[model samples]
Target: METLANLESFIRSAEHGSFSEAARWLSLTPAAVSRNVAMLERNLGVRLFHRSTRKLTLTEAGESFRLAISDSLSGIQAAIAGIAGDGGEPAGVLKLSLAPTFGVAHILPLLPGFLERYPRIKPEWHFENRQVDLIAEGYDVAIGGGFDLSPTVVARTLAPAHVIAVASPGYMADKTPPREPADLQAFRGIVMRSLQSGRVRHWTMRDVTGREAPVRLQESFVVNDPSAMRGAALLGMGVAMLATADVLADLENGALVRLAPRWYSDAGAISMYFPSRTLLPAKTRAFIDWVVNAFEAEKLAERFAGSLDLRSSRSG
Candidate 1:
């Protein structure tokens, strides 16, 4: 009989298309994943993937097996959730994937209060800078940003906060602040790009007076994450355009300054999305409520006003 270990490894490998990627998804070593696949192959007497230098390709037998068993596995998962309801709340391990920065800046602070409210929902946080496949990875929920989630998932918007154009106090002293969006081309800046969004970070901004039109920026560095780009700006590397929440503490301490607030468009929204289904566990629903309320109770909306406002903490 094929062991569960072998079956799981094969499924992950097929989903990821590489042993290393599958291992990363499972929090295991590539060698361990390879071993599991090998064990499965030995039991079934069939090669699953045709390994080659170019790329891994699923064999005919492998494709058929995936189609047959994937839904069965999902049904098994639903059964587990049903059984875990004996506690009368969310009683299963929840695998949550999120951006590392958002996880730190927002979710971590909110968690203590949330945990105090619900003792039954134990959360396992997975922090990654990359987008994860919820279905393939079996994640219960994920916190995403500026993303249009797949049709299979139900995305819920929690709070939308404006992004601000910001720079360090030191950088502003050396570089004259751009009087308007067009002047951004004259200053050094950073751009944050991700798999989910566009790369027009330095392009333009607007107010009630219609769009300011397109403009180019003198980018000194380009990074894949907002937090990393913000760190570079904090070290006086260059200016950065960031979400209000991401730099709330620094702006409060006068470490960073927002420039010409009128030149910025509304950006940055905190959101939580989950797989679309008829039956959601009570624990999951409780968590969603706890988190949304926490943000509202903390006056997360008010924080945005002063986050990168280039003003003193006293004003906040």
Candidate 2:
């Protein structure tokens, strides 16, 4: 019969990719972990890992087994913790991957209240522009758009990832704003290069009547980060197609003006992602519930949709 010790050893080794690293996590010696995994292999009658002196790699069979048992192991650990009184306080270091601008602007504000409510929980968060592997990286949660989903992950939509062209108010002051998507070809453009792909992304924008057009602008600068692009646009450098959520403050404050209020690109939904459908830790569950409720109460999706012209509303 296979014990949880053997299964845990196999799963931890698969996650860390080494017996030594797995030993560090399991608080056991490397030899002990290796022996446990070997025991598991003998019990299952199949080799799980390709072991070498330098490193360890999961075989195809090992990967399959890891995926199958990873969530179950988490559930078991969580169950044990719950029984051990960890469930009541929701205490732990909750690690999260968040987008640089949006997470700071929107989600970061919610943390104070969350911390107040759950005083035992500690947060360790990183703000970046790339997709992180949730399971392999040991992230409790990741908040972003356009992440590749795995079978062990779950996502909840926060908002529509709407993007539109914007420029500094001073830049648009002396120039005729683009009345149609085709007219943007005449303007100097600040564009974004994909950090993951290292390619400049093109925009396919649609008008109020659902007329879609691919407008290639004259590129003045290309940046990898959205905040940098927003900064450039605010400096009257060039027009930029940016996510509405990212530049909501600028647009509302008249630091930037919309090139075409009706035109936007529906990139995808901004979502909160986390590992596993079952046995989420108390800290993870609390954060998810809190953020979802906040988004709903604030109607963030509608406010950040980029269709409303604040200047027009103020004038009226």
Which residue pairs clash within candidate 1?
Answer: none
Give the Cα-based TM-score of candidate 2 against the true structure: 0.75
Go through the candidates in order and give the clash count of each.
Answer: 0, 0
Poorly placed runs, candidate 1 (over 4 Å): 1-87, 193-201, 266-268, 305-316
Quote the RMSD, in angstroms, for model 2: 10.7
Candidate 1 colliding pairs, count: 0
> Tens digits of per-residue lDDT for model 2 on 1-316?
5788899999888888899999999999999999999999998989999988888999899899889989988999898876577435588999999998999989999999999999989999999888999999999999998889888899999988888888887787777777777888888999988867888888988866778989687777998889999999999999999888898887778788888676788888999999976978778999999999999998898877755543332111
Q: Among these predicted structures, which one has the highest TM-score?
A: 2
Q: State which candidate has the highest lDDT.
A: 2
Q: Write candidate 1's Cα lDDT for 195-229 as tens digits.
A: 55656455456654665645465677888878888
TM-score of each: 0.65, 0.75
